[model samples]
Target: MAKKRKVDNLLALAVLSTIVERPMHRYEIAQTLCERGKDRDMAIKWGSLYTVVQNMAKAGFLEVVGSERDGARPERVIYRITDAGRVEMADWTRELLTTPEPEHHRFVAGLSILAVLPPAEVIELLGARLDALGRILEVARRELGDLTGTLPRLFLVESEFGLAMLEAEAAWTRSLRDELIEGSFDGLAQWRDWHDRGMRPSEVTASIERGVAEN
Candidate 1:
């Protein structure tokens, strides 16, 4: 189980990871995070960065060491990760690495209500999705291939993991599409019958509910 955090936003983790190298002002932190592609790894709201940093300080995870002025620009306070922050970062990382969490993905949500669409239409949509996934995998593979020998494996492991997940999803989607196309999907007959009979979605759902209750 995940424990409650003082700064629950993932941007705080990105901030801690970046500033662990050295104390940085907010601008520098945001810049470094962008440069390192932290936004891709986590959902980061740029507008909420200031508040996150302030809350981290209040939580004793960070401390303002000094202020820096760049010419006529406003002063930026440099923040350093406190000992508590380091502990928090390490603990959070450990929890993430070791624990399994349920994430509700958009694709899963659509699949849960898939009976809303006819099987033929669903197959067509899946084909389109597979094509898009193939293109994305191609580009990502090319980029990662270029970076492979140039950078150490440690840095590229995240990209590797991401590619693995995409590949898995693509493979599973392909299997499902093949099953539907071959008329081998277990519930494909009932699904088609509902659409053939021009049954409303709510009626189909109620029928399915009764079937489940009887079962």
Candidate 2:
């Protein structure tokens, strides 16, 4: 089977969004993103910004409009969004908001192989994670609070979503930790026993089948 092409890029969206405002050179786009605090909403690197612009031009999402040299500076190429780019940007943004895509979060990856570690040790590690997440959540809340009077809520929606997710994860982690400490988590015994006994291939497959059936 052929692999699917990935059209989603945080930087690409940032670039397209910038170009939509007005055609600009690469440096100007980067400057605008920084000035608008787009970095808070998406990961932005100076190098990657140039690469995404090149790729967008190659994909016909953008076309070079003109070039200019300012004194000692190298000539800079200005670009504008193509008709295709506008359509792509709008479609991609809508899909990103409405569609559920598979994202590999580190916490989920650790949870997947959780049975490999002793329950007590897993609890310790997760507790550490909870502490770190708590600190991050506190920082996010403080920053949001400070920005409340300065910026409109519409501009900070993504920040709000991030803080909410962090809060939710912290809550769930606390519940799981308490269950582990109390020895009351469902299926925990079977999980511990399988791990302690050095789980066999058949046992693993059987457990997965049973879980599927139950669901």
Candidate 3:
């Protein structure tokens, strides 16, 4: 049985949001996440995603829609959001937008993992991430530009702040990419033995139970 891990609320929210749009299988969810360009930081891992989907289904936030074989592979499970999932998504979205932002450890964890990637590959990855971020930033900029006099002054200020944040992130990414290309930093193994050692016995048991339940 696969071991269970605690699911991140943001990851759960992301998966639920995507499922709300349409039903999808695990691989499809991963592909959609890549397409959405939000997984660049390695904040979302396949194991974590699979775990979340299983837990959400168990929690009644999602329902299995159907299953079908993918070519020669085994049958794939597809899922769609339950009504409860939609309500949870809405509630989370509201909380996300209205509440003060919380410090996100996932970002740090991602960077730590990225530290293990080959220097050259890291540069390439960062370039791709920057390109994706650029596209998103452009769209946000255009949308905000169109809202010049349409939105209230307070909203305009908030929008500008959001854009500024994006710009700062882009700039930081560019700086990191340049540093990597220039060979300014040496690569290090991130998460060395932590992956296996970090799992608590209780958590491992929970994961095993979850996996057995699923199977």
lDDT of 2: 0.85
Candidate 2 structure quality by residue, lDDT tens digits, 23-84: 89999998898887788777888788888999899989999999999999999999999999
Predicted candidate 2, C-alpha RMSD: 3.7
Look at candidate 3 and tell me the lDDT of residue 189. Answer: 26
- C-alpha TM-score for every candidate: 0.95, 0.82, 0.49
Q: Write down the worst ten-residue block by lDDT for model 2.
A: 1-10
Model 2, runs deviating above 4 Å: 1-7, 194-215
**What is the lDDT of every predicted structure here?**
0.93, 0.85, 0.74
Off by over 4 Å in 3: 1-8, 104-163, 166-215
RMSD to the true structure for each prediction, in A, is 1.3, 3.7, 15.4
Q: Show where candidate 1 strays beyond 4 Å.
A: none
What's the residue-level lDDT of 28 in candidate 3?
Answer: 90
